[model samples]
Target: MPSSAGPSIDTITEGGRVTQVGEGQEAEESVPPVMTFGAPTAGEILAERYELVEHINNDSAGRLVWRGVDVVLRRPVAVVLRYPGGDSATEMLQAAVAASRVIHPNLVGVYDAIDEAERAYVVREWVDGQSLREMVADGPLDPGRATAIGNAAASALAAVHATGMVHGNMHPGTVMISQEGRVVLADARTDGADSRENDVRAVGGILYFALTGHWPHAEAPLRGATAGHGRAAIPDGVRDASGAIAAPRQVRAGVPAYLDDLTMDLLDAGIAPPPSDVLAAELGRLDIPIEEEPYPEPAGPLRFAAETGDEPSPLASVGGRKVAIGIAGLLAVALVGLLIGISALGGDDDPLQTEPVARPSSSAPASGAAPAAATRKLSVSDVRIIDPDSKLRDELGGAERVTDGDQDKGWDTDTYTQPNFGNRKSGMGVWIDLGEEHTVKSVQVSLSATGASAQLFAGKTDPPSTSAGDKLLFTSYRTNPVGQPFEEHDGTTMTFNGFDADAKYRFLLFWLTALPSNDRGYQVGVLEITVQGS
Candidate 1:
């Protein structure tokens, strides 16, 4: 029998097997949940080995974090409520194993998992600081700090997704700022979202909140790099088609447009790249670039390029003061050529009607020859100027492909999907409730090169076989431009034939070569994905 201190009497029970005691029955002490939030105000202390310190914020599923103790250890330890829906001992182990693989500095590290009498308990490093939400409650951050935080957060997401896992619950509140001002994800959740895209959208939400100080602009665009209603399902702050923001200029003048654009990509790239790391890198190139043109001779008389005062070329410079010099001669030649073009243009009476009818200057050399090599413009698809892969992966909650197998194309939550891939990660996922399976001769595919960079392979195999990998149907993608960046939001599809769609392969394959720096990849919402029958 256990003794009680006051009104709260704690008790202990076993698996029953109690023996009969002769005439000695007494009231037992009642046991609390064995945990309390923050400090224990006036609750019953069943065991005096530990004390409650402070409470952390609430979780998405209403779970809470408390600063608690091992009276034995006397050290600060973060204690989280048991995660529900894990069903049994096995699920608890799976969730724990998946989380343990991630090793990143920016990510909150899990110390241990405790399964106490059917309830799961998680203990993590105690971060003695406020959350980003609390800090931003007053107002948005200055540009520099905001950009730094964004860069760091993006890095955390990148590390997580690279392991082939999702943070399931990444948001502002989930980000904790250490006493030293380092931001770490509160918890790397895996218990939510059937697909990885949910995490992507949530990442956008975090950066928006971080920069704007509020969630008023929470809706960042989804993964495509285009502008239209076909891909218009993005949240508010994102502009149409392009994964661009609502132009930071609107939020505050002198705001870096490059930062705004990158913020949009990072927010939109979920699990592909954390926006924080991306922002940090973009901040380096964040200055307003000074564009220059080839030296334009001043537009005054032909002597402007040479004169200091209202003077002439060195032609006006004579021997020392007005001699014909380099700039002066070049100016004179351009002036004469301008006179000829002006004459050919019929003299501005008709600006649009000026026809280029001259084949001339053959005696003056060919002017139509292409100038020396032009500077190559970096597109959205190939801009590796600020590659944040290494930095982003530093936080480490990346996704990992656990199961890879080939089977008949039927909906099997238990059946794993894997394809013959090359130089990258490849697989297809969908939420399918296939009723009566029918023959599938053709399949529709939406291969996203924006969020998750990948190649799509479509082939028909006799008996619908993926075995021996001999059945080669059709492959689409630039072998050379595999993960190169492009300047547009677009996608492509491939078709295969010469085999039986009878194997029920209405669904196709997704070969993820590289995730967008934002952690973009293949994902399907409840209604967005479907497996059809022929």
Candidate 2:
């Protein structure tokens, strides 16, 4: 029988019985062993492919977690086994299956789920790092790191929510941070009791925990407790006599004002939590380097409003910044109006024209003009791969690397048989969102290889961050290219200065028409992209 205080593996006896020892507790005497009749033991093989190696521990819900290996694939795996298959393990199995469908870098990959009459087990990617709960054990994390973890969790949940499914389980335990600095969300328990809104709110809990080393949801305990069953290993949020939990900033020093506002807003029941994607984008924007200030000096506490149909609430709009959620349609309208105004001014040639013009050396306001609208590097709020024709969505994983200010790491397309994406559906590109509209300037793209045919397009509206949305964007942008298309450019660096000086642009699509030949085949890599505008 599993103890009330979560089980920790001390040793596996030859009889296939696991010895449970509590952390910091010493074994004084040889304890009597419990029945091990139906329990899976060390060295047992399930599904003929997964060979159980070591028992990690038993979770709060009496599920056995083992560090296993896929004999066939020769990869380490985490095997979660629950006794008595059938109805008892329905929720676990279902959640595993659903999670398996969504493949994301920040989401732990669910390999296989099986039922062996007496027991049910789920085999998933074995993360080699500690959980958020464990990471914060020493102390709260820095605001930057906490923000990165929040961004990763939110991004993973956004991908999961895109499939119209709720994660139902987003907590410190589920948020895994690997040794390689990879943050992945694992152990989704979509038990139908939780809503998508709840999932979004859980991100707040995660952020709060990361910043304060305290679990906010004390009343409603999350999964994975190192000690007590159902209770989190982390301490509860510092609450007052009124039972109101203190904000992160109040608990920890150096927590950015915007991050504090965002975390508290998500935890606030009164204020609605932004959609996962919107929250993810906001977090991504905040996940900046320590050298750069996270946000403008705070005016007041930021708040979120209930999302109305088609209209999103003002999400993370602090210090008068216009960070509205789901404004793609409105952006499109704004773009259309701008184009019409430009067309009216430009004497009949379609304002939405794609004509190659002489590339300017600089976007600086010509000699002797008002100090050129102080060109600054505009931050990208969000980015996604627009692979409309591809069946595999695997390419969407590293899209963030292109803008991470790291040239060595980048996002690249799969190698193709031919230069033009193996002659498959037009071409694929990256979609970029600049949070809000900005004035005209130049866009610089750093590529890994030269001679790849590419085009830069600026759009008014943002699209849903999905495959279908990618298709719609691809079709729309291809029909009416914004700037001149670069056909077989000579070098890796490409600059587009065709942006209208007076026009304000928000979204951009960097569409690739062809690829450069590599040692493997034909492929192109976007090392880094920088937008210089007001």
**Highest TM-score against the true fold, candidate:** 2
Tens digits of per-residue lDDT, candidate 2, 77-167, equal 6666666766665545554554455656776555666766577666666556666666777689888888889888778777667767656
Off by over 4 Å in 2: 1-41, 86-92, 222-233, 289-303, 306-534
Deviation of model 1 at 148, angstroms = 1.2
Q: So what's the TM-score on candidate 2?
A: 0.50
What lDDT tens digits, residue by residue, belong to model 1 across residues 202-260? Answer: 54456555566544233322121123211122223424354334434345554343344
Q: What TM-score goes with each of the models?
A: 0.38, 0.50
What's the C-alpha lDDT at position 462 in model 2? 65
TM-score of 1: 0.38
